[model samples]
Target chain A: MDISSGVTETTIKSKKTVKKQKITKGNMTPYLFILPSFILIVGFLFYPIGTVFYYSLQHYDVAAPFYNGFAGLDNFVTIFTQDKMFLPSLLNSLKWVVTEVGLQLIFGMILALLLNQTFKLRGMARAVAFIPWAISGVLASSMWSLIFNEHMGVLNDLLMKLGLINEPQAFLASTTTAFTSVILAELWRGIPFFAITLLASLQSIPVDLYEAAKVDGASRWKTFIYVILPQLKNTIVLTTLLRVVWEFNNVDLLFNLTGGGPAHSTTTLTMYIADLAVHGSNFGYGSALTVITFAILLLFAIVYLKLSRYEKE
Target chain B: MIFNNKKADKLITLYLPLSMMLCFTIFPLYWTINTAFKPEGDIIKRPLQYLPANPTIDNFVNAWTNIGFATFFKNSLIVGVATVIVVLICSTLSGYALARYQFKGKRGFMLMLLCTQFIPRAMMIIPLFIIFKNLGLISNPLSLIITYSAVEIPFTTILMSGFISGVPKELEEAAMMDGCTKLQSLRYVVFPLLLPGIVATGVFTFIYTWNEFLIALMLTNQQNKFTLPVGLASMMGEFNVNYGALAAGSVIALIPAILLFAYAQKHLVNGMGGAVKG
Candidate 1:
């Protein structure tokens, strides 16, 4: 009996060792698979970001000395003091984030709630609603550009036809209207993201809660306020935060539509940086702007993290 | 009585969303398509025609030749397909690793990847431009391909990781026990099951790379090397707006996206749903 038990134990030990070996082999294989992506990220993503930081500290230019001596915080100081467009561009960015993110979230949540109902053609309706999101940002802006065109735009033509306004509105040319038009275009493209994300969240909510509320003779508003809103609280906050970051960074729509427009009314931080680098030929200042924007974004992220924490506890 | 109120409430709920969506979604498309058919002169004329008065295919024909769209289409296709393939391959392996393996620095690496998604691409544009220019890759379509793959990898990896993790580990174990090599197990066992995810990722990567404007706009200098968006953007000059040709070009550009979305609608919906859940 003792000899038989010993033999079984030895066989079990052998199998366990073999299993360990196989597991390590399997584990190592996934790393091999991920190697290409790691290489790509290092080359394209990390390297560029590192270079931007490096250039931010230097007084680098195209025609001038390639890697000039470090300027310390001089570029940043110049950006704050000397750069006339800095404060205005920053203000515009804020306006964009506030209006675009706020409207998108509110409208999106409302729409999501409305669509979350058990209705015929819900799927078709959802798909159709999501179409704007699929449109390229550049194309969407261009489409809106036509709508807001000063001479031949549809908006002015419609307004004139309806006797709302007799003259053509220079929607994209005017400072006030330029930002508004760009924001409207952004809202059109962005609302779909909010709608889809919120809709998914809405769907995850079980119908049982509503049924329970109904059994208790709760009103529609009461049920939503007490039940639905609570369930959606986390999603609403996260989506809003996400939208803020995205809107703050979005440049293409504004760039194409207005080119920061009639008198730099719609110029954002991104456009400002691009102008500095590509058009203005000031790579140092552009890198500085890039660094500043990154810092601001990091601050926003930190604030979001704090808010998320507050919500949790 | 209860049933009646519920039905009415349902109708009311559906009505608001339906109308809002129509206003937001279908109206722009309607506007674009309508304008495409309108005469160039009539586009700016007052008493706005909801329908085209004199519809002409001339705009399209002119745009097709003027913008060199056929070449742009081919360029976009090459870049898009290459991006999709690279992202899929890289993401799948990385995702599998993140999902299945308990490795050192695993969490840190994932967090790093996620952090990359937050870094605005605009911030890195100048540096990337310089790097590509230095590498002599700016003129090549492969430059955009590489850029797209880099930007897309993190999101795709996260997405694929979630999907792969949901796959039963027991099945993989069984395959291993059957004397399958790790790669063989991944190829024959895990990969087949991840087809839906792969398709979704592929479609997404394709759309993003295809539609990407800023990087493409900046990188490609020559007219012949232009992608659709860049080509379309170049049409807009300071003074004179070519309404007919521009609208025609814009419409042409929209076709590939629309067709791809139509083809992959189901997968996209599923993929987006999964992403949100994750």
Candidate 2:
């Protein structure tokens, strides 16, 4: 009787402890797990974003801090009415986004479709095609710089050999060709991104749909239009929106290649802001520009998503 | 006759376009490599040698020892590895929580993560510069590491969550029923399966940190502290750039990213596709 009572008592205690453990795990474990990421993101990202707004209101030029104080609407006003570079740079940003993302999408879609087709050495071909995506913007700029170089560029040599140009043109230095050259270089790198994303979307497409289209006597072009395009709609919308934002902010190639120069012709808004932050010490004005850029991007995102109804099937 | 038509169609539609894309994709890389191996004098030699006549490693030696690319390479590696560890730890924990539990703010947290995708990375430079300056972390690798981790965590967290969700819940339950502790169950049951996802995420983060130029340029002023991209940019800005050394430096920077991509690319595509599809 004593042994049985002892065993029963210990079993009851263990059961109670298990219940307690369950309660704690259910309530606190997940929060604890999430705590580190929450802290770092909030401390670094979200907090810094808040400070951009705060600094935008004051004259916080690191070059001349003694003149810093509450400037109120002056910063925003200067950006709107007085700043000469503002409107031009904004327009340049629009042009840059349109050309870069548009061309990248078209070429990337073509590459994706081609890669989707079965052939020998497809895996190796896919790997080679996607290689440029792994390259950094700076590296791409350097590689293109070599090709666009006046003296040593293979491009100039080829163009001259083909009687296209009498002399080696300074592709990057000339204002007329600078933006286009940069676009082409960036296009080389950017196409791989779309190709990869779209290819993934393509892989997920049901094979039955294609067979059905074929059975319906659809030509390849007709099938692509009727079957493939509809399946890829969501991916296209999402990737394009993402790419628009990404390409808008992409200052790497422009910064390294042209430095937004040759009469400031290629100075997109983000590039202009980057120039301000780096070369100019006017943190306040720069922050103000940043705010405007942020608002424009947020507005664009909202309008784009609404028009596309990205959330809806 | 039917086969002949099919063959002609394939030639026009597939092989021709495919070859053009390949040339467009491969030419720059090939040119860069060709330039890297050529003697500096022959680099700009007229007739533009498609093949280097006198290939040499002098540029590589010069860039590595004298031009401070070695330092840049080391710095990039340090930042890349450290950022990967931090992102992996933080993201894995949060991913586990997101995948397994029923929490009140789960949906809100997910929405917040998605919202970060829209945050303009370029605009953050000024604020981040100030924040780092105030913290006295300018020119410090820790700042880059920490900042990169924060930048990477949301995406990685989502990725990890997707990967973790892919692991069957029943497996974990079975391990638990086998009298293993929760930690033990996870260690034995889930982690082995999650290794590929972890590796892909690490490579993705590493590549971003390695190639990041603008922020690295802002955060570090001392040349000794420069990353590969910053170093390359500075070299490009020099009045008389050594084209050979520049090409060599690029090849060095390009290797790790390309190698890592080649290794983890299959998983990366799937993981990224899954993440975006969600």
Candidate 3:
């Protein structure tokens, strides 16, 4: 026993030494492994952001001499005070976030709750429901655009065919209709996310809780209110926050479907920035706008993190 | 009595979802397919036909030839394949290290990766475009491959790490004890277990790269180099919308995504449903 114990003690000591060496080596290894990705991020994400921050203060032009003199806070002032489109675009984006994310969450939750039930062909139904998510955003926007086209749109035709309307409507030409059209397209693409995420959350809930509630003579509504809603609260909050950030930053749907058109009615911050950068050749101003957008999104992200913390407790 | 109630409850539960699934899910698809088959003039004509009165393949033919869809298809394929390859390699190595090694800052590294996803694509577009332009990579398909890989790496790594963790380390250690090198141990022991994860990640990478528009739109400026989305977008100008050809193009773009999802449906579903343990 003494001899075996002595042998085991030596093994343990050697093992500890090996572990210490391994730990140190392992620390370096992860950094080495992640080094390439870190370099890419720095090269692509960090450096450009830093450049944008710098450029935001400079008076640069895309064409006719790229270099310009320092102009601190002036560009920001121009955007905030001078640019008439800026405030309205920002408001439109805010409206988009509330409507798109809000409606997506409500509808998605309802869809998820319905899908969560055991039924024949449940898998097929779920897959069918997720088909819209499989379609690319640009394609989805284009399809909707065709459907909303003033003269050639199928929507008007369908409504007329069904006796829902008397005349063909110019959905994309009017400012109010154009904004509504963009929001609807966004919602169409976004609703699936809520359904999928909420469905996943619903699946995670144990069936025993519902069974137990039933055993206690709880009605169906009472069981859903007491058992389901409380459990889904975290998922709902997180999804809502994610949807807000995503919707706030969305560019393609509105850009493609509306072209921020009908006198720039649908031009959100992203579209505005892209317009300045790509079309207007005001890279410096665009970069400034980009920075501002990031700042706003970061603020929201911090709020979301804080809310998540509160939810955790 | 209880069994009957449960049955009735199940049926009741299915009713709303089924109706919603038909409306929100199937209607748009039906509309698209319906529009795709309609005569060019009937597409915008009043009183939308539930079924195309005069379906024709002319739009498909026009979309195929006029839009230069063949080139777009080739570009999308090359970029998608290249992204999958690069992502699989880089993510596998990083994921393996993350899963197996007891490293300092592992948690922090993961958190950092997750944080990257929150940074909006719009924020990265300008910087990425500038960086690629500086490197003289504008209009290059290879540039897109690199950018897509970079954008996809973090998620792929996270997914792979989850998968690699599920693989037993004892097998690797056992292989090592047999005088096998670390690389050999990983190749023989750990890699087989990671195949499903790699497939899942590969499918996602392919789909994302295939569907990606903004980066592809900005990066590749040449007409011949334009991917499907850009190609389709070029059809729209100040006036004269090619509804038939555009609808046809939209259907064409749907093919690869649908086929990919179909091929990897099981793994994709599993991956989406939290198979990525992290």
Better of 2 and 3 by lDDT: 2
Instruction: Report the Cα lDDT for residue A15, model 2.
Output: 90
Which is the winner by TM-score between candidate 2 and candidate 3?
A: 2
Error of 2 at B215 (Å): 0.7
Shift in Å, residue B118, candidate 1: 1.2
Instruction: Give RMSD (Å) of candidate 3 vs. truth.
Output: 2.8
Question: Looking at candidate 1, what is the lDDT of residue A188?
Answer: 84
True contacts kept of 1: 0.54
Instruction: List, residue by residue over B1-278, the lDDT tens digit for candidate 1.
Output: 76698678766677855786668677777777788888778887766788899898877887787658778888889999999999998998899888977776788788888789678878877898899899898868989999999999999999999889988998988998999986799899998998877887888888898788878877888888888878777776536878877777788888888877766665654566567566
Best by TM-score: 2
**Which wins on DockQ, candidate 2 or candidate 3?**
2
lDDT of 3 by residue, B55-100 (tens): 8988888888877888888888888898899888888878877887
DockQ of each: 0.62, 0.77, 0.54
Please report, as a residue range, the 10-residue window in candidate 1 chain A with the lowest summed lDDT. Answer: A274-283
Q: Highest lDDT: which candidate?
A: 2
What lDDT score is found at residue A245 in candidate 3?
A: 82
In candidate 2, how many Å is residue A19 off?
12
Q: Name the TM-score of candidate 1.
A: 0.93
**lDDT agreement with native, every candidate:** 0.82, 0.93, 0.79
> Candidate 2 on A1-313: residue-level lDDT in tens?
9999999999999899977865777798888999999999888889988998998999888889899999997899998999999999999999999999999999999999999999999999999999999999999999999999998989999999999999999998898999999999999999989999999999999999999999999999999998999899999999999999999999999999999988998999999999998899999999999999999999999999898894564
Candidate scoring better on DockQ of 1 and 2: 2
Candidate 2 Cα outliers beyond 4 Å, as residue runs: A1-24, A310-313, B1-3
